[model samples]
Target: MRFNVWKRLELAAVTVGIAGVVLVGCAAPDEAGVSDARVAESFAAMYTQWLTEPDLTEMDRLVLDEAQRTGRVTQGQYQDAIDRLVSCMADAGYALQLTTYPSGVIEVQPPVAVPDGDDLMSSKHFCEKTTSIYAIMGYEMQQGNPELYADPAVVAFNCLEDADLLASTATVDDVKRFMYSSERDNFPFDSEDFGVKACFYGAGMAYGTVAEAE
Candidate 1:
């Protein structure tokens, strides 16, 4: 296996910082074209890029299409999340970075972890959002190969929890709307619909956290 050795190493490395599995994003099979080393490199590069180039508009453009394609979020919901996230970041004086992992997962690190920032993510609400997103990702990948990863329904549950947190501030209805919209947009990819759902669930969870904080 190309990633057998590297996978072990990456897991160990990540475990040292053990923020715990907060979000469960989709992960590809071990046979996915991208090698394990490639996955680690990609994750690191993406993380760095997100930190250096923190633009809300760019994030919206890049993530919205993917979210829509996978039924992760509706365009309107995406916009709302974006607005809410940006506002939260501005208010908290923090930034966000989305790091893609080879396990077909994407991990998010708070802005406070950056060179100069304060950590305001200790709130219970923030933790719920983080874990929910990861579960959502897990769910998305599970639909395709449930045994290969963690439970997909966990993603849904976490996303739901995160949405509840945001309900006090923003309209939680939009979260469901975005997910349905994402499902409608990705109608063609039937077999991979589960994967899409997982992805969207992650998106919803992540966005919900921002909305709640805002």
Candidate 2:
């Protein structure tokens, strides 16, 4: 089965910072096509871009807070863990770039905020919202060629995870609201009426599915 190498690598890149799987906002697959090498290069580029941003502080704090809440680390260790995450990303990015993967053009928009009045840190909320969005992409791909890809529902669930970070450097509440609103409004697919197929078509990915594009 042709695996959507880009999507898989995208999942790896975003979740690499955390201990578990995590999802960031969605991005349209590259029109130029995808390959394992390209995916690695794209991931490296994305990771590098993410690291350069100052907004990552909120994500760092969120990770630390969760660690403390779970008793995984003492307060004094928070900074250390945060430092480790950065180092990890740096190392991972470098490693991915070292591969002989080909390059592709994949455009990802910043996440749109969707106001669901849900808790920002709620795993359920993040999963449900992201799953809904990913499901659409999966469905569209399947419609084009079922044998080409795996189940969209399964991929969406496995690939996407809750993110406790935000961009504005604002209060957690403000950041949460902004993220939620962005996801709701700016989703590349039209989620209105929850039409997964329609949204996929709208994304202009209907001609080909994102299933492993080997």
Clashes of each: 21, 15
- Supply the TM-score for candidate 1: 0.24
lDDT of each: 0.33, 0.27
Model 1: residue 185 alpha-carbon error in angstroms: 37
- Tens-digit lDDT string for candidate 2 (93-132): 3111111101111222111232432432243323323222
- TM-score for each model: 0.24, 0.18
lDDT of 1 by residue, 3-26 (tens): 011011122123123333222334
lDDT of model 1 at position 49: 29
TM-score of decoy 2: 0.18
- The lDDT of model 2 is 0.27
lDDT of 1: 0.33
